[model samples]
Target: MSVNLYRFGKTVVTIILKPLFRIQTIGTESFPKDGGVLICANHIDNLDPPVVGLTSPRVIHFMAKEELFHVPILKQILPTINVFPVKRGMSDKGALKKGLKLLKEGEVLGLFPEGTRSKTGELGKGLAGAGFFALRTNAAVVPCAIIGPYKPFQKLRVVYGKPIDFSQYREQKISPEEATEVIMDEIRKLISAHK
Candidate 1:
């Protein structure tokens, strides 16, 4: 990955979003300075990824839907911005392996646990992929919430909750589904708190 390119992209995104949305980022200190980390957030709008990207203290490798890559411009731009395509609603082992590899390299990964955007803007049930990655790599799981509609000039808050420790569960017998709920619950709390 090109560090300079990522920085440039971040700068451009910040310039466009900051004044337009008046974005507010909270609890960014909760992100670990090093090591593999999984950032799980609730998905409401298509803009959520860039919103999280601009506010994040570290570079985030986000998993986007495969369809987005089909767009000519996005196909060229997404990879340059550290966005990888993930096939949703089915088992896409290639994407899963890519995410796992990134995590193992101590990269921060951004994912929406719900698998897709919510039509009602309500938090939905989390899929197990995030939990599986967390368990496999033992990465720090940070629950994030993006609060507010995407209206121009409105206050858009991207709140990051404390890192959830999976050390205990790592040693025990726990299903990925159960672990996912733990992540979702924290995200739910963040949305409620910020709203």
Candidate 2:
């Protein structure tokens, strides 16, 4: 049902992107087959979500900006593809609860710790949300990187790094802010590797 629609959307996106961006993915084998998983990446542009969703082996439920959900068509279609809205800047308790519930059900949750796109392509300071969820759920956090010029007719790369365990950090009483730094550092390395 929903899964079929997701795959259909991915197929459509892949077909559309193939002739435009030369999409290349590396280290996909590191993505977990099943479990409560979190895919944390650096945000560069609006295309980051769909690009990651289309390339990922698993169906990715993205935390989209709340504004996108208000668009007429997307308002009706987003839920079918598992995209939920999250208000930016201030905390959105409902979105956080939804994310936790999804992870508890062993779903793949995609998030960008930077919260907003980086216009310069340089990785920015991460928000604590990703680490907070990782610590709370003890989910495997897979660091992802999106590289290359973010435009049509250019080579774009999606790189995945090994899953990071936040359980130890949680046990050691490390703050979510500290854990975010660690996760973002790994994401930085992945992006650097491909450059």
Candidate 3:
């Protein structure tokens, strides 16, 4: 690949994604400036990851779908941008291992608890993967919400909630329902503030 492609991607991201989408980040003070953390958020649009990443001052490693990797052009620079692929639905142990390793290595793991984009324009039920990762790694879980349609020439905001401790899940061995409720409550609050 020529150096031109890399230059072109950076230019497009800066010129297009940046200028077109006016992003506002609030409560970023809640994010741990340094350390391994499981950053989970609601999934409304595919743009959520990049919007959150750009807003977050901390270096974040994103867990994107494996299908996006099919792009020959993107394959060149995605790595430099800190994006990774995860096989949706199935265990995808490879992705799990990678996610855990990133946390263990003291890196931020960007995840979408809903697992996929919401089809009905309402917050969908979140999956247990985020909980499983948080429990396994003992990383702080920061609930975030990407609030808006995020179309070109439109302004959007991403709200980050404080990191929640999950030690109880490991010690008390509470039911999954309890853990799910704990998470949804935080996510709900983040969404409500945007409206």
Candidate 4:
């Protein structure tokens, strides 16, 4: 990964966004300092990734839709900024394996559990992919919620909740769908708390 590029991009984004939007981050102290962590947040706007990444305490490697990589400029820039593509809808084994490897290597992976943006800016149903990674790696799952509209000069908040440990469910016969509910519930609470 291009660490320098990621840092540069973050610096630029921060400079541009700080004035346009009143951004606030809460409960960032809950983020794990070491080891793998999965950051599952509710998707609202297309800019959610960068907005969340900038407010986050850690450098987040995000899983973006595969279509984004199809653009020539984005394909080159996305990777430099620590963004990777994943096929949506079906089970993309390649993407899943890549995410698993990153987690095993103690890297943080950011995913939008809804798999797509919510038009109404409300939290949508969580996808099974996030739960699969959480249960498979037994990494800390940190639930995050991005609140407020994307309008200029509007109040925007990114709330990070306490890390959730799914180790106990590893022993039980828990499906990814069930595990997803556990993660989503935490995110829902964070959103409600800020509203």
Deviation in angstroms for 111 in model 2?
Answer: 0.2
RMSD per candidate (Å) reads 1.0, 1.2, 3.5, 0.9
Count: clashes, candidate 2: 0
- Which candidate leads the pack in TM-score? 4
Cα lDDT over the full model 1: 0.91
**lDDT tens string, model 4, 148-182?**
78889988898999998787878895999999999
lDDT of 1 by residue, 108-136 (tens): 99999999889999999999998888788
Residue ranges of candidate 4 with Cα displaced over 4 Å: none
Against the true structure, whose lDDT is highest? 1
lDDT of 3 by residue, 1-195 (tens): 234543454456556676677767788897887778888888888777767766776767888888888889877667767777888878789888988999988888888877889986577787777777877777788988887876877877788898888897768876544665577678889889875
TM-score of 3: 0.85
Tens-digit lDDT string for candidate 2 (46-95): 88888999888888888989999889999999999999999999999999
**Candidate ordering by TM-score (highest first):** 4, 1, 2, 3
lDDT of every predicted structure (CA atoms):
0.91, 0.89, 0.77, 0.90
What TM-score do all the candidates reach, one by one?
0.97, 0.96, 0.85, 0.97
